[model samples]
Target: WRNTETSPETLSDSQLRGLGIVEGADGTINFESGIVVTGRVEKILRRDGKLMLIGFSNCSAKQGDRILFDPTWGTFDMAVGERISSVFNGAADKDAYNQIALVPKDRTIKVPSDENRKKLENLYAQVRDIRDRKVGCDRLGEIWETQQAEHAGDWLLSMQIFEILDEAGEQNDLKQKIVTFLNQKKLTNKDISTLIEWGFRLVTYHKVGLQTAAHGA
Candidate 1:
């Protein structure tokens, strides 16, 4: 098990963008285990619509490293069978399998579709207008966070955001909290409806934003 909350957020713009992959940028990365490593990015591969294989070359762990990657689930394992890669003393880059970090894929709850994308965009446009108000709009941030889901390449996180809001909306206490927020902000019933409708879309279609580009899904 590893922790990512404290993982060094330091990475290049490209490395930090989208999936925050560490390849193509020459530098060291600090994992939650506090193990620091430096290497050249070998491959930036996506798998199963939700994870990436961050591969590196000439990699080294701290003087005494404890990080370990299992070999069974990666293409690197096949390299050994083909006899193209080798391992020495369990070194991290002894072969292909040792050099990859399976980074989590960030995307929406459902694979984005053209129809859902347009509806979602229109809904967010309205949501954004509501957020521009002075009060009762903190609830609007939930919708804004969904935009982050699209950028992070993890729609599941986006879906979870909507899920939390939906759960809160179902409960009287939580729903009242949101209602009071809108009242304080002087937002209208239509505003509340838009917020509720956004959640409904998530529960129904589960889209964060329109997928403007094609990603290997």
Candidate 2:
């Protein structure tokens, strides 16, 4: 009845008796073909560490139908359950499929509202104009170009541009404009942390440049 080597078709009468399967008895195979096959259990084999049920069915089963001994079996529902489990466990590859998961909820990047996006775009245009006119602000133009090429949606680059403009002794009017916009804009803690980190890195780079120039002098 449960021999690993016994073929389903070659099951003897004694083997059917051992499995308690009688001819015309109710047997269910959990598959896409959801029909109760009334037949005797021909043989059960443990192949690849899984129980393979071989039986003669009164109804014709399709070729690709998964044969199972019972409807309450775990493997029957594995396909549906695995998908749900992978999403919640964060084991699913985000790039592979566009599924939204509940766990690790904060991983999604919040896109700016249309009004905010328009404001940022306008600010970037003004910054570009300043870069074109200002002598020492060619670096700003390079940064803007890089942002446009790599991540046009990145609003943090605008903040960095404003910082650089203020450092370059730009007009008070522009500085005041930046300050007012920043005060009105609501930034997440993560955004604030990033700005602080970028500011520190900028300061360190400037210090290193000054040290190198002094050594050369």
Candidate 3:
């Protein structure tokens, strides 16, 4: 937090990996800086742009480092929050820190109280910093756009391939261009397989050029 540089390129792979972080591994993704907690992945969710969890609060929890869990099965994160809130107005959403998990308690008794809720609110409000949440729909749209474009490209390549099916003229050149474009789009394994299988052949891909009339090009 002291050195104010957020450029991701600033960190090397080893640096990030050293923090128990791995790229492209799907699990809990911590986009914000906060107390670094490490444990088996538990329930993770987004509530009002704040990433939340349902694991034991004392489990290797720290303050001011981004953390990711492998992901867990449960509605505990929200369920606990809402249940506590319902019983005694435990945690308010306006202040992101007002959550159920942060409540300190004895092992025997479990009851909601305003004082404990306030403490949690005050504690996280001062300590933890939740970042903005990313929209899954937005990411989905990006995938769609890239896929559509690739679909279009395959059609174009098919035309080229069809013409040069019997000759090497310009084939390797077009093939190289296609490879570069595919990498940029981050195509999935299945997408790559399908593209490779029918990319140049362009069977079901859509054409993006001008539609031809009876006497058009």
Q: Please report the candidate that would top TM-score against the real structure.
A: 2
Q: Rank by lDDT, descending?
A: 2, 1, 3
Which is the winner by lDDT between candidate 1 and candidate 3?
Answer: 1
lDDT tens digits by residue: candidate 2, 31-94: 2223223343434433344433343433322223322222221111111112322322222222
Q: On a 0 to 100 scale, what is the lDDT of residue 94 in model 3?
A: 35
List model 3 lDDT by residue over 1-217, tens digit each. 1132433324444544544434333222232434233443343333453322234322333234211111231111222224333322332433212222332121222343566556444432322221122122223223323434533422222222322321223345444554555555435344334323333322222221112222374
TM-score of each: 0.24, 0.29, 0.19
Off by over 4 Å in 2: 1-105, 113-116, 135-158, 170-191, 207-211, 214-217
Clashing pairs in 2: none
Which candidate number has the best lDDT? 2
Q: How does model 3 score by TM-score?
A: 0.19
